[model samples]
Target: MAWDLSVDLIKATVQLEQPVGDGSRTVGTGFLISDPTPGGKPRTILVTAAHVFEKMPAMSAKIGYRVQGKDGVWRFDPTTLKIRDGDHPLWVKHPTRDVAAMEVEAPPEFVKAAIPINYLAQDDTFNRYNLGPGDEMMALGFPRGLSANPAGFPILRAGRVASYPLAPATSFPTFLMDFSVFPGNSGGPVFMAEGARRRPGSNQTQEVQFVAGLLTQQVELSGERLEIGIVTHAKFIRETLALLDKLPGATVTQAKAGKTVKGDPPMPPATPAVAISATAMAASR
Candidate 1:
């Protein structure tokens, strides 16, 4: 069951690529987020790395986004969606957070496969799992543009949690793990075990289920052969969801948001866009 859940989560995330200077390309990852747009929904929002979208020229030929399918397979196409707050690049710099988000026209082949993220609810359960040193985590992504390699599916890599949390570097609670992340894995998911918490009266805490963090950073030691990967706390997931709600005409609302069913809601869809943070600034040398 745990294995299945991990696969399901990967099926929902995507790798984004855009043309950069001199015909080179920048790559990152993002996962699908639920939008409440009405029928003929233009695009789905994908959260990923900020740097991936930054190096693009305004009139680039085309953008590319890739995601896993329901069958645990990789699928991709040229993206027609545009970066939301692309004009405000400084607000979404990599050193401070390293996260970026954009919307894509839902492709006909991918409509039923994507899963909308419940960032708020996931954030509420962050503490349900006591992640700490020595824990093992599974980080899955399409590294080195390997989505179509080997088996044409997302790659899964396992690693151990690092010596300490990464909050100091990212300004948020983060996990340092020993996963090998390549270019295409920048915005993938990093899931860790959240064992059942034991209460004072109870013998042990019951097991709670869900994803733990969004893979964000990695550190390469000069002499060491292996690298350490970092993941941002789940709270930022909630923040991204909130910002999505503030978009001009989004229609998605959570079950607790005065809505019960998981069906689509009425929405006046607008062009897909990436949202930029207001207080965030660019990293200095």
Candidate 2:
């Protein structure tokens, strides 16, 4: 297994934490992305599941990013990412998807390791690879709010792509995998890396990596865990960002420092027509 490939993938992964007044925290996973502009500065978007924000709602939630300290060791640093600084909605939720993207002017520390937009799987890449069941895949995320190291690197879990009709991605836009996902795994990146291939019309070889989708939730049945994970396809992610790009750009409105922001929670978007809950749907053996 090319586990080393995770070095690049985890760099873009961010830990979403909402600290409560009772010294507890709500945790989830998110990643950073840079979408290129024709002639302007590329916009930095924070990608995560919409349900993440709704869990223990807060106005100004903090995102955890790792950086090396003077001791030459990585340490976690919390940055206040304002979701709603006063009356402004800092986050953009996909109209009907379980996705949300925010146009954030993150500091160099956070943006330096973001995943490039081109890593997203395009239609051609899917067709060329003939992606379907049995294809190897990896999920980089913080399951149960647990990271790999003090640097806050995500835990890399391997599984196989288990779905159909991946080529023409259906309008509902989702897939499934066999990883036993925990509650906190939502919004993590699902990817395949450096698959060796012959160059076009030549015998030369090259390596290609692509992000496929995200771990949204787990399917449970009657107090039992199914070990099947629901993956929200990458197409919806691209769609969410595209929807954001069409709007006018605006400067970030920061709230006063040290003040814990608060706001009413937003409603969770509707689930896909095919309910994959353990009770609603069974795992394909």
The CA lDDT of each predicted structure is 0.49, 0.68
In the predicted model 1, the residue pairs found to clash are 36-251, 36-252, 83-274, 84-273, 84-274, 85-274, 197-205, 198-205
- Candidate 2: where are CA atoms >4 Å away? 1-5, 37-39, 197-206, 253-285
Any idea what lDDT model 2 has? Answer: 0.68
Please estimate how well model 1 matches the true structure, expressed as its whole-model Cα lDDT.
0.49
Report per-prediction Cα RMSD to one decimal: 10.4, 6.9
Candidate 1's C-alpha runs over 4 A off are 20-23, 35-43, 58-78, 84-96, 108-111, 119-126, 148-152, 163-172, 193-208, 221-226, 249-285
Query: Which pairs of residues collide in candidate 2?
Result: none
lDDT of 2 by residue, 1-285 (tens): 353446777887877766665544567788888876545777677888877876636677767666676888876555667787566566777787778787776667666677888787765676676567877789877666667775567788988777776666554377778777875678888888855756666777666578887777776767677788777778878888887766686554342222332452211111111111111222431
Ten residues in sequence with the least summed lDDT for candidate 2: 269-278
Q: Pick the candidate with the highest lDDT.
A: 2
- Listed in order, each prediction's TM-score against the native is 0.64, 0.81
Over the stretch 174-285, how does candidate 1's per-residue lDDT look in tens digits? Answer: 6667666555567676764335446446676655445566666555455342466667665565455446545566432111112211232211111112321111111211
Deviation in Å, model 1, residue 193 alpha carbon: 7.0
